[model samples]
Target: MAQMTGKQYKESLKKVKPVIYYMGEKVDDITKHPAFIPHINAAALTYDMALAPEFEELCSAKSHLTGERINRFTHIHQNHDDLIKKVKMLRAIGQQTGSCFQRCVGFDGMNATYSVSYDIDKKFGTGYHERFKNFVKMIQTKDLMPSGAMTDPKGDRSLSPSQQKDPDMYVHVIEKRKDGIVVSGAKAHITGAVNSHGHLVMPTTAMREGDKDYAVCFYVPIDAPGVMHIFGRQSNDTRKCDCSMDQGNCEYGCVGGEALIVFDKVFVPNEYVFMCGEWEYAGELVERFATFHRQNYGGCKGGLADVLVGAVYSLALAQGTAKASHVREKLAEMIHLAETIYCCSIACSCQGFAQPAGSFQADPLMANVTKLNVTRNVYEIARLAHDITGGLLATMPSEFDLHDPTVGKWVDKYMKGSSSVPAETRMRLIRLIDAMTCGTALAESMHGAGSPQAQMIMIERRGSLERKKKLAEKLAKIGDQPVLIC
Candidate 1:
């Protein structure tokens, strides 16, 4: 087995020197930092599960390249079953952790790179395919976590990368030396960048003829010189430091710990550069990566929905409303939405076929459909959770008040919902619901995989509306008249 234990994973982070800033201060050790530890714990769960007998099959896979048992997070999909298993693994992790495990983006990135690099080689006779295969093999053998960098900070939404007033608005190759290239720009909303072993950086969008500099892709160590990360702030992030009860899902925190990673003239050796100035293939790479990433939401969010449902159910019971007709109906609705997303993920996976490079890819249409529904479904699901939990979710008193000598007794008395359930229990459940529904978790659900409109564009392109119109015309007895326009 080429996998590390949770303890080993945490120990490994202490060796890296990633320059990370949080709340205007440099974080020397992310593993011990309160703001990052919950996310780390969530990610560590992925490692811990692989060591268990029951979860071994779901969390570990036989690497195609090395024939060794490797973490599923590092294995490229070898078949449709592998793809299906990926979703199942994500959901299982989600259920257990009740938060983003923060590894799926890297998993998806490797798969996309595996297939797209082969296609790029076929088109332009580049050796990127072989280089990428070696990279994947190294990742699996070492069990490294590679954060996928795709989203860029678009200074002007309407402008192209080349048109941005700031040349570094999109990551680009500033200097191509004999050894390799130096890239300068920043990748935004990068999930788990601080904790990951390194990054698999890819272009954020398609490139035109003049955008050659921006059409670059490569990998870099997180602690590489000139690479820096500014940690993103989450809702109630400060609560992590002071209030235990108020920090709902305290063990796993909120969504994936995201950050802005800046590449300031970071040098990459030739072996690490997968694509450079491949303007034509940029769109293909973006689509492949984005589709695979979108498919991930189904499993992870489904797992999250499971947690939300459980929290809502617990809160309902705490408030003595679990058996009400309307409550039951709303709970059922939440289940329906969650299952629907999971089904889409599975549908896309089951429908997948092998790519040219022998890696399986989900059906683009179904994957986009899965994500599009996620954009809307997660919100409604959270809405029902909030509806069931009631006003206490937002207006609940801090844990300090519950423990205060002056107000503790009265707070406990009035906060108590039922004699059977403890006041503290009721308050805890309410806090959990509040954090999951109203915090970073919900935002990630809305915009994590290229946002709602991006998924819609992919869906529209894949839909083939003209074919549907043709079917409608044929059914309506409208013949194809060639001379009607005269």
Candidate 2:
């Protein structure tokens, strides 16, 4: 196949079986498991969508190195327009999935590394960039998903990687050999780890020269020796099993259905190692990835917020509250919130700049602003959703109850908000709202890219508060003029 059609991609995942655990049980097959099925389905859509004639331009990109048309996820941002298209494409995927598709982390990580490794070679005379290119080519050719692994166990948040109570708190080099390195540690809260074909692993945070052991980065198959994936729990996740009305987004579980991936004595071939001992550049790599990922949150999640807004508005109509002044005001607030998030992301894309190697980087300040706004807007939108949805969302009987022989009539009668709207329809919408607002959706918003604190730190560090202050001072006739030393 010229492009590894979506069917081929899914078929390829069947070749390597990852050791996945959920709720103390080893999953025999992840693609069939309820917890993972939705994630897989959502990801499959990303691949399938790429082949559609209408979306080809946005979903695919010409490989800069190979001149092949690869999935846009494999593309390195070539210019400001490419950056904008990346954001737009993410929004489109978000609208389709209505949850984190769980692919963008690796997408951003790979692109960031593509550019960073090139720069690294310029200074260090290393061949990392070419190695990365080869890896990308393989992934694109095989149509494999490479989940990006960054965060470590980080046993003690206050301590540096080198000083942690356990040296493995942050993934580090345990054994170095002539052939390759054996790494031991774990990556937590990994999105789509179980469904991915491989991992693009990197240090969770910046490192000092003394922390060289922790500065390693590499890629390996998901089912590589000593790799295991364990699923995390989410609120009301069991609804998927209960077959109840609360099975929010029944086709997909909560945000990305994250898992913790353990790497115990995993040997990474030397060819796969990209950043071994490059401690100083670790920070640059991380910052760049975070910037791109943070921008992504605004695009994808913001588009999801659009769906939420529409869902709530439609819900208001079903409840006969659509014409109410308060309901209209709530809907407007949601629009305002969604647009605020979207605007920040778009603004960042339009202002992208070129890196040393000519790859485009989003405007740091705008990207930070976009993610920061999303962090807050997500909460505000969720709260407004709850307000518009009313209290019955929590107390509603199970879908099974609504379908039960004896209670079905009573449940349907009382649950009716509008005379013409069917009870089942209303319940389905409410369940969807609950799924998006109450469970993983909210936390994903708070976290998906990074946590609220993480966004605020970026806002403080990269945002133009100084520039704003200078503008204010200059406008109000305060502070020294722009002056330079002789």
Candidate 3:
């Protein structure tokens, strides 16, 4: 079989019994759990789009190893076209789900691991690349959703892994046997932690020599014994329980519910282990993954921006300000910000580069810049959305109050802007706006790939200040020569 259909994927989830916890209860049916269902629905969209004629080209690709058609999430991007298709596919999914689908992290980890493992083997004569290929092929064959777990629960930002207060704070190899290794520690803010069929884990940061225990990378089934998921809370997430209006994107999962995934003495077989005790290449592996992760923010965030823009515009109509001069101007400003993000996304893809293994990577500088733009652009986009929405975006009454027979008529009369638009319609628009702006939506844009600070670091590292200085010097012939800038 090629890529699995949405129905097939949902059915597959029933076979694997993963230990998942959300709110205060143990979740047995992940596919249908109230807190987890919307995320599953969002992920199912990844499967559904593969069968759509218009999106198939962008959403699926032939696997580089097995030559079978697989979701693009499982395929290794091979050229500039692949990169462009990737960005577009992310945009399409964002439009379809209008929220974080919580699957791309694994897609990125697979690609990043594929490249890094290949490089590691070349330098150390290991068979990691071949081992990784076999694992990826299995994932593609099953059409599995594997969440990539990278970030650790770093207790102290100032200390290194070896110097931490707790030795297990960062995932580390606690036992090494002839067969494999046992890793004990936890990953924090693990996106889609409990919902994934499998988990692909790697180092969150570069490692030094003594930190070899912390440099391990491998894949394991989410249902692996000793693995546990503790779901995180988001702003207004209990609305999920209420199942009410104004919760925003209530039908779709909230900001891809992240959880603290603890790997307590988890064991991996020798074949499944890709990176182990490779200190020197740790930096290389991290930078490679980070660059691609940063590249993704542009596509996904730009798509979310579109939804926000659409929400604001829709709210304007419901409020009867669609024709007002200020409304028109604020809407225009929103459009400009939206397109700016989209342009950055497209530019990064267009300027993509090929790897030694034939996979494509976006220009590091451009990709980081794209995400940096996402940080500021999305906030401003929300500001404009809020501006057009007026006070009601913040002060809108509860649907319950409006639905009460005693107050329903009063709400219909006073809580509306235009006689032509129904009060309920205005309420729906407000709910949509509230969903896209507060809580998960904003956080996704700010820290989806990495935080704004992470992008700033990338900018500083990849930016060419000397070259910029040279351009100015050349105009005045003030310097002897321009050193090539990194």
Candidate 4:
């Protein structure tokens, strides 16, 4: 097998039988469902773009394991350049889709597991590294999209997994069999879960010896018996199925189509299990995954911000306000914020270093900073966009009203911003702004990869404050005997 084309990718889903439910109805074919199609379209581009000559350099990579050409999404970061290209690739796709393509999660998961498995093997003489490499090869060869399942539905935030009132609140290995193990629980807000080929399940947080059962990582086909996905609702998701103009970015939808994936004692074969009871190493895997994942916010969100900035500018033009001093100033601010995000991603990538397993990772401190900035900067960019676009962005007439014979003329007349620009054109741009700057899109920016607090935690641990203090003391000559200051 080789990298699949977009058409081939869509056709591949027919063979996948993940149990999916949306709006109280069983979804038989996610590729065909209107609600899921936009997201599927967004993901399929990851395949199509890799083959395009214009994007091949960024979207495709030579597999380190097999020396075969593979989608970069499936390739392990073999060097610092590979890490940098990952950010470029994400931005390229984000620019095109103007929404979440939903593949980076698994890409980060593979890289995190690759290095961690090797360390685990070195420490415990386990074969996890080899198993993980084989799994990576399969994904690369077949061009599969696997959701990285990490966040568990913790019933009580204060309690550790082992102390939870319900053991299944966190995904755990309930029974270890000779062949493999049975995992039971749910992964919430799992991006692309309903549309992916399978899931790379990992522990959500660090674990102690008592939490051994919860320190599990493995792969399971989405359609495995006892597995089911409940598709999540977005702010204006219904528009995806009902209206065109109302569904801003109708071709790609807004945000990754997320879902809640449940494992009811799903059985996994030994060949697919990457980690079993390695509780001590769970934190390493989590941090590695978080770093790699956080490193993406600037690339993806920056690209999306590019589109939002364009939308606001277009709206301003349609309203004949493009030359307004305030609008121009706001546009400039949005551009600065978007590029600042891109700079952070690039900086982290440039600072990437090799791991013990011969794989590369982004600079942890900078990567966390990059994501934290995204949590705030993306919102600020959206706020500026709204300031320039006006309240019509939120109060625009529905596409239905524009099409109605009775009210159509009235909407066309009253909605006209500039007589030179079609009311339809203005409406489209406003909708795009509305879709990209509002509810679901903004929330994903704030919390995706990890929340702002999660990034702060990493930043605090990796910030090297003590080292900075030492440097400051040496510079000031105040370490052992303080020097008199002028």
- Model 3, 136-199: lDDT tens digits are 8998887788898988888898888878989988999999999998999998888877778888
Superposed on all Cα atoms, the candidates' RMSDs to the truth, in angstroms, are: 2.6, 2.0, 1.8, 2.1
- What is each predicted model's overall lDDT from 0 to 1? 0.90, 0.84, 0.83, 0.93
Q: Candidate 1: where is the Cα deviation over 4 Å? A: 480-486
Who wins the TM-score comparison?
4
The residue-by-residue lDDT of candidate 1 on 45-137, one tens digit each, is 899998799998989999899899999999988898898999999999999988888898888888888898899899999999999989988
Stronger candidate by lDDT (2 vs 4): 4
Candidate 2, which segments miss by more than 4 Å at Cα? 243-245, 464-486
Cα distance off (Å), candidate 3, residue 223:
0.1
- TM agreement with the true structure for every prediction: 0.98, 0.96, 0.96, 0.98
Q: How much is the lDDT of residue 322 in candidate 3?
A: 90
- Evaluate residue 181 in candidate 4 and report its C-alpha lDDT on the 0 to 100 scale: 96
Compared with the true structure, the alpha-carbon lDDT of candidate 3 equals: 0.83
* Superposition error at 321 for model 2 (Å): 0.4
